[model samples]
Target: MTPLHQQICQACMPDSSPVMDDQRASLMSQLPGWQCLLQDNIWQLKKSYRFSNYSQAMAFANQVAELAEQMRHHPALLIEWGRVDVYWWTHCIANLHYNDFIMAAKTDQLNVNSG
Candidate 1:
């Protein structure tokens, strides 16, 4: 199977079902440091990355934005002085999907390559 980071996100429909239970667990294993959480009654994949300073954090956020545009799957990003918090979910589905996992893995890849 292809690594999650290497997989491209497919277009999701509003009626699509969120990845659940065993599938969610399996995918989550491929991404370390990411937490599965319920926010606003919806499941999301979240992680926080630390940087040396605000500039570094903003750079990382920009990288993430580029990745999101390429994959056509965006995340919620909270950029601060030295950290960035990312939350990935399919808003159309109003929950977590495989695309979220893919984006999370790609986000990790960006951090690895940048550091």
Candidate 2:
């Protein structure tokens, strides 16, 4: 994975706390690759994208890494045989920050073209 500092887009942090409904809508619209899974206090975005082979999976991983680096946001990426799983969270807030989900959404957007 690329470095966190390089992946973050520090300038675009939304100014308001998106209402719950808005948050969900944003997630739905922007992050198609990620499935919303609510944990204790965090919103996790996960998905498994198929690949033709190991190299394709590795390419996707590299793509995600680049995006993460550019956004200065990082997701835990688990690379299995032919798929990758990503876990996203914001530790600073102790719960899911709106930005975390936003980044998740954007990352999904990035993956759309990669596939």
Candidate 3:
């Protein structure tokens, strides 16, 4: 099977079901440093990356934005002076989907490629 980072996100609709427990567990295992959290009754894949300065953090955020655009999926990005927090979830379903994991993995790759 292709790695999550190499997979492309599919168009998710409102009716789409969220990732099941077994699948979530399997996918979660593939991503390190990511947390699965529930907020507002929705599951989100989140991670924080540290940088040396604001410029580095902002640059990473921009790279994530470009990735989101390319994938047609966006994440909530919180950029601090030396850190960036990324939250990935499917807005239409208000839950975590396969795309979320894919984005999360790809996001990790962005950090690796950048730093």
Candidate 4:
């Protein structure tokens, strides 16, 4: 199977089901330092990347924004001094989807490529 980072996201329908427990566990294994959690009653994939300065963190966030645009999947981002937090979830479904995992893996690659 293709790695999640190299996989393209698919458009999700409103009725589409969220990621299954078994699949979620498998996907989460592929991502290190990432958390799959429930926040505000929504399941999301989240991670935080650390940088030496605010500029680096902002740059990383920008890179993620560009990637989101390319994939047509957006994430909630919080940029702060020396750190950037990314949250990936399907807004329409308000749950975790395979696309969120794909974006999370790709987001991890962004950090790797940046540093």
Candidate 5:
């Protein structure tokens, strides 16, 4: 299978189903330091990225924002002094979708390229 980061996100329909458990597990394995959790009854993929200082964190957040804009898929980003928490989910589907995995992988790639 192609790496999630290499995959492009497609528009998700409101009636589309969430990714299956086995598929979720397989995709999750490709993203290190990422955690899957149920928040407010919704499953989201989350990760905390550490940086040296606020400026660095902000820079990372900007990069993520640019990527999100490019893909037209956004994440919940919590920027802090030295860390940024990112959460990925498909709002239209009210659940996790393949796009979440792809974005998560792209986020990881951004982190790698930034540093």
Candidate 6:
């Protein structure tokens, strides 16, 4: 990431409690792979990829887990067959946060690169 963009991201905070409608829209656009759930203000993503059968899916899940751990953030993970769903929100912020969306996008990038 560029230094300027990194600076901006570092300065960001989670969306304020009771997420505003417009902010939600803006954040959703910032996230390409994730879909914004209006009512909950959470980002949700589901993707299916070829994974050398079930073992590959498991490996990918582990990778995601490691990423989340290192980020000190977590996303709800649902693994089924060859699909994975990631749901991200900030509990402390009580809504979706900038970091959450950023990390979600990073996750997508990781998946694409791995593929």
Tell me, by lDDT, which candidate is best.
3
Clashes of 6: 0
Error of 4 at 77 (Å): 0.4
lDDT of 2 at 78: 86
- All candidates in order of lDDT, best leading: 3, 5, 4, 1, 2, 6
Error of 1 at 28 (Å): 0.8
TM-scores, each model vs. reference: 0.98, 0.67, 0.99, 0.98, 0.98, 0.70
Per-residue lDDT of candidate 5, residues 3-102 (tens digit): 8899999998999889999999988889999999999999999999999999999999999999999999999999999999999999998799999999
lDDT of 6 by residue, 1-115 (tens): 4321132223334445544668767756655656666345544433344466677777777777887777777777778777667776766666666666666766776687678
Q: Give residue 35's lDDT in candidate 1 (0 to 100).
A: 98
Candidate 5, lDDT over the whole model: 0.96
User: Candidate 1 lDDT, tens digit per residue, 1-115?
Assistant: 9998999998899988889889999998899999999899999999999999999999999999999999899999999999999999999989998899989999999999999
Q: lDDT of model 5 at residue 93?
A: 84
lDDT digits (tens) for residues 1-113 of candidate 3: 99999999999999999999999999999999999999889999999999999999999999999999999999999999999999999999999999999999999999999
- Per-residue lDDT, model 4, residue 107, is 96
Q: How many Å off is the CA of 97 in candidate 4?
A: 0.7
Segments in model 3 whose C-alpha atoms lie over 4 Å from true places: none
lDDT of 5 at 65: 100
Q: List the residue pairs that clash in candidate 3.
A: none
> Can you write out model 4's per-residue Cα lDDT over 13-113, one digit (the tens) per residue?
88989998999999999999999999999999999899999999999999999999999999999999999999999998999989999999999999999
Residues forming the 10-long window of minimal summed lDDT in candidate 4: 11-20
List model 2 lDDT by residue over 1-114, tens digit each: 443222444433444343275666654555555677777766666677777778878888888888778667778888877887777765444445555666665666656677
Pick by TM-score: which candidate is best? Answer: 3
Model 3: how large is the Cα RMSD against the reference? 0.5
Candidate 6: residue 103 lDDT (0-100): 65
Q: Looking at model 5, report the run of 10 residues with the lowest lDDT sum.
A: 9-18
lDDT of 2 at 69: 83
